[model samples]
Target: MKPSEEKPAIIALPKARRHTYYFLNYADEFKSVYLDTEIDMSEVKRRRDKLKLSGHRISYIVFLIEAISRVIRLYPEANSSVKHGMIPQMAVYHRIAAKFTLDKTMDGRRFVMSGIIPDSDQMPLEGMQKMIEYYRDTEADEITEFANVRKLQSMPLWLGRWIYRLAMGNLSRRAKLQGTFTITSLGHRPIQAFYPIISNTLCFGVGAIEDKPVVMAGQIAIRPMMKLSLAFDHRAIDGALAADILTEVKKVLEFASESDEASTQGEEVTPVGAST
Candidate 1:
């Protein structure tokens, strides 16, 4: 057969993924600064194992969210987003809201969506995990947010673009709709490091955890390590502040112990949307 005659088949883009194009197009408005660091997950693994043995299992993403949320609370500048105009303005949030994406299957096709955990700094580890589990396990059609995403996908491309921009134009609503920052992970695969785009001021990229050689006490030893990458809009955040936040998150993750878990469990705070 002639090479020209043996062409590969092509498929149309699914409506479910239509929003990603809008998101990427919108992300182009910001100039993002990227950084990556390796985190030693040895202690965190040990703590998680202990918790799991006690029937209080916590997911790695939830744990990282809790830690990073606290760090975000410490750095006010880190919890802000920029609104561009004739002169740009920064919208600082009083609460730390963590946004994480989920891969959902709808109508036999897979699509990605996100969920927000408001006041994440105040939420306990178990509570955050519960919300994440809900997002992961629930049917996409059943959840109001995911349902809205479907509606957007079903709209014409121009209409969807207008609606998305309208919703994202207001910083306050954008924070509530999205979050102060975003966390995306490819940890299920063997990928070690990658950079992500930013909608808000910051976006965190998480890579898989694997055994790697590291120096400890002046000796090389194998340790369970994960790659954490941060992408920040330089217009809203400077490199110094971003580095500080990344370092703080790394410290919170690497030095985490059973005591840290105990402290969070002892905090008297309601879950994200619990009635008062």
Candidate 2:
């Protein structure tokens, strides 16, 4: 065939798998909830400074994940997913999982794929930070869920498009590959609260953190503030439940600076491995 007339590449998925896109396309509406909260990061800042001196490193994402775990533990619905069915039943997960994507360099080009931390409600900030760093550096392997995604990306553009949508769009498959809840961020760049897309049942968008004045102990004081935005599947979660979940998440984050002995709000959570 002539170079210009070359056929588009095609990699076929099993009939059973190809139907995944059908279910994913059923989601009709997504509701976004915007939350603005000011946090006291004095303790976190102090710890970060010390950790840098010791050659250990961490970021707000660690604290964000830590807080996320606590909220998922209490709000079982937030950890749940809507089943891909005629009725679209809601499935509440006994274990909580949070998903995110990290940038990776492959062939000198940037690649991003889904990642998950299962049973996240049990992991601490330190553990979450370490996990994030590990995923960022690791290649496609048993430890890396992006291996299949990377493979799919290698196909011809035309073929990759059909397969990618069918594979990633399938809610069931995505939850299995990624997680029930998703988190994405533009890093620490934007100041105003940004509304993130509601692709999954629940999602968190991390915004910039800058020094902003806030009321503390009846006096205005400057504190490092960050913006967090949430998107929820209206079919799976109602506004009241979503609000409660967001409130609890904020509480966990604000109190993240406390010691383990001081995290008396709820018992700590653990990471649950991959699940279908």
- Residue 269, model 2: Cα distance from true site in angstroms: 12
Residue pairs with clashing backbones, model 1 = none
- lDDT by residue (123-177, candidate 2, tens digit) is 6556667778778777744445555655655565556556755665555566676
Give the alpha carbon lDDT tens digit for every residue of 152-257 in model 1. 8889888988898888878888899889989999999999997988898889999999998999999999999999999999998799888888887887788665
> Model 1 has how many clashing residue pairs?
0
lDDT measured at residue 91 in model 1 versus the true structure, 0 to 100: 90
The per-candidate count of clashes, in order, stands at 0, 5
- Scored by TM-score, the top model is 1
lDDT of 1 at 14: 74
Error of 2 at 143 (Å): 7.1
TM-score of each: 0.90, 0.73
lDDT of each: 0.84, 0.63
Q: Which portions of model 2 miss their true places by more than 4 Å?
A: 1-36, 46-56, 139-144, 156-173, 261-276
Candidate 1 stretches with Cα past 4 Å from truth are 1-3, 6-12, 262-276
TM-score of 1: 0.90
